[model samples]
Target: MEENQELEQELAMEDVLKNYDFKKIHTGEIIKGSVLKVTNDEVIVNINYFSDGIINKDELSFESDVNPFDVVKEGDEISVKIISTDDGEGNVVLSKKQADEASIWDSVDDAKKEGKTVVVKVKSETKGGLIASYKGLRVFIPGSQAAARRIELNTLVGQELEVKLTECDKVKKNIVASRRVIEEAEIEAKKNELWSGLTVGEKREGKVTRLAKFGAFVDIGGVEGLVHVSDLSWKRVNNPEEVVSVGDTVNVFIQSVDREKNRLSLALKDVATNPWTLVESKMKTGDVVEGKVLKFTTFGAFVEVADGVEGLVHLSEISDENIAKPSEVLEIGQTVKVKVLSIDAANHKMSLSIKDAVEKSKEYLQYTDNEEESTLGDLLKDKLSGVKFE
Candidate 1:
């Protein structure tokens, strides 16, 4: 009788322990867990349930290279979301990433409402734009909203960019961001700052934004200015495209600024680098050079000796004979040889003489004619005239 009572009491205590171990937990439940073991691939956590929960490396963080030990160590308490009650191995599957995503969504929503910007990492590119990850949520930045139109969208891949949330719909699980919004705001602020300190004759480094028949438009610190074709270079420019192209960086001189019309006149070539500054290195006085008649004036004819450099041929110097006007001897677009009489580089002026060049040509021909007639027999006769031969 005593042995039977001992066996019955032992069976009753076993049934009570089994009932206590049965904790009613279902899938998709938020539970508190303690890290039991951590490894490179997975982490084991005890959730005070019948089975311990398994948190894989991918579930611990959205980053691919995350270490499970770095996320959770032994004896650390963490909140996790239940993925499955049984992962076919009788162990519960939990995700720490999914649990943190809920709070990230709330933060994104608040940022949208508060008009704040968020920083996101660009994961990849899609058909129309870029795909970025804000925490674990995917945010779409359209091509038009990705960056300024001048910037290539693909260059932003794998870079962290700050963006403004244009649309945040938590119910639909859709989020749209715009880097252009942030860039445009910064541009406007820079424009205001530039205008406050803008002055005529201010030198600036600018990027060529557009080309037109008359001029090129350049962006100088958020303000645009026009560089007229004539001012593009000292050399003649038929079109602005010949001097500058779109997206070219150049230095510009602000000639004038009209606040009322919002117009700016810019010059690309300044006096410091003008062709006249180096004219003496190319030619000097008394040097004869071939030139083309560019235009005829009442005083003389403007002849081009070099590109962007013209010399004046006075009416008296146009020909050896007297002339009524420069056009009588020289026509526009005619090629003529001229001698440099004087030069004033500081004033960008040069005086040339075509008559002197013609005279010098005659003297050179006469000298060559006399030399061709001389022979070796004439040189021997001249030397023997003062000596007696033995």
Candidate 2:
């Protein structure tokens, strides 16, 4: 019985000694505890010390305004730093906020060294950067690093973004992050996926992002493709902007692609009717047609009779009277009537004659004294009979 009583007394003394072991604690030491009681402004934690430790609500987190109950509840386990072993009342003064800050700063250092990513929540905007939080530690993200493009700052508030630590100063408490770090990688991955699946002749829907004299750029998800000026429409296009404006949703067909160079040749006209075929179906040789002069060269004038269809009028065919050059009789954008002298629609070629058309009018006038008008066939025969082969 005496041995049993001594064993019980030893066990009780061990338990009592364990409860009053706060003397072993050092200032600024981090220790684990469980919440014993929670109040409006303080959380009573059992650090298994001499007395229950108190953590003020203000020290619950770095945030200026915090509620103790919101952060901890009875029986919840948390790590706290011993701000003081005894506050003169034999009680430990603990700080959960300081512990968290120290731990996060260490993490920030590791992230910078290892090039790791961390999540940040935007809290507000400052003059040159956005005020953000990483596990309650303040971080500054410059405006330029917030995104690949300029973005509205107000919309970013309360938003969470993954970022890379670019600058960290433990003494100054200055930490900087860049959201663009992750964004650039995401953009590249998206582009790679799009390039891998893209095929020639595939039709894609996109929005016109910008226009240049040479082409228009379109965003069809992660990649941008160029629609060259000549491919904007079946008709002649002097400027890409003339055919498609910025922000216009356009349907285009991929004409060709170069994965190595990350380039795409696109055409808006391939899906539409071939204008050359339309010209063939509507016009025949000796048929008079109205056209507008498109350009001039030393030898002839090129005129457009229909969309995407042009015919060349040689110097000899410009008029019966001799002319030094086609410019003497025709100017760009000048509307004139010409006879379709020959057409090879399959090859998209056509020859026009202004002098022959005038001669045909004269033939009608002279022959009209007896008959109405000679058939185009009879007119052709007369013209061919007069030709002398060299």
Candidate 3:
């Protein structure tokens, strides 16, 4: 009975030994553990070994003044490298910083292979480039790759930037990055989207950027469109400056878009407020209106009867006597009284007769002479009734 009892006890001890891990823990081996305790200067971790691991304040991070409690709390799982299998007190010595440095190079290599971007904090501006920190590693960004536009390098210090790694040499421990690559790609994407979504007759608000003799270039979003001088306003525009100046904010419509040729045309005149809409209500046939001669063509003269509205005086209607051309009897800017013979507002056209106007004036003069006892105002009012004058 004594022998059987001793054999049972030995079997139980073998089972207890089997439950514990007998794997040897060595220095330089990375392992994972749960934080068992956290103090101001040290962190105690449970690695399932007979003894707990301890990480001193200096091993918590690359920063010189970091506290152990700030980096980890109790029950938090962390990966650390074994600095020694046993310290003087029988606890495993661990370093979180060494483990991070060992794996950071692999992380950077993976990111580069996948064409992924990384976030870096600018530490300082160097002689030919910028020095930035990525997981405690120094990354070099050249001056030409710093930004898409001109910028002061010193201003970037202490700011975090997103960049693409262009070159990585593990042997030399060098990494080159660029922020301009990402910015330029984003700009090109926006330009392409703007071009694809555009349609003719879409209204947009833009700023005039440049003025030329034939047209003005306006920037709407990231794209530029040309506004021809002829399309600037309803009134005659001899120069683009007459309607819009550089740096002026204006509303425009897309007149035409040629994607193949990469040409865009814009119009500044508001079609809703076209002067032709006012022709029918402002004047009628046979009403004598005072107008200024605007321009002369081979057969007729264009006269401005109202703001932005012009009427044509044919050579036959210049005077009672026939003239070879309207310029023979009328000069540009000359004020004249003309009778409206026809109005085609839908077509933006009107016909005027200077001969008929002269006949009306003669009748008014005769009527005034017959009414000698009447006041001059009363005679003029009766003769001018129903006449629309500007």
Best by TM-score: 2
Q: Which parts of model 2 have CA positions greater than 4 angstroms off?
A: 1-11, 18-24, 110-114, 284-288, 331-335, 370-390
The Cα error of candidate 1 at residue 278, in Å, is 17
lDDT of 3 by residue, 1-390 (tens): 999999999999888667556485778999888999989889999887878899998998877898777788899998899999889999899998888877887888888999999999999999988999999888999999999888999999999999999988777889999999999998779878999998888899999999999999999887899999878988877889778888999999999998888789999998778888988898999899999999999888988898778889888888877677887788889999999999998987899988889899999988977777567779889999999978
TM-score of each: 0.57, 0.83, 0.66
Residue-level lDDT of model 1, residues 278-380, one tens digit each, is 8899899999999999888788898988877889999888886877788887788899999999999888799999999988888889888777667655887
lDDT tens digits by residue: candidate 2, 80-115: 999987889888899999998888899999999999
What lDDT, from 0 to 1, does candidate 2 have? Answer: 0.88
- Top lDDT prediction, candidate number: 3
Off by over 4 Å in 3: 1-29, 34-39, 42-56, 82-94, 123-131, 142-159, 277-305, 309-390
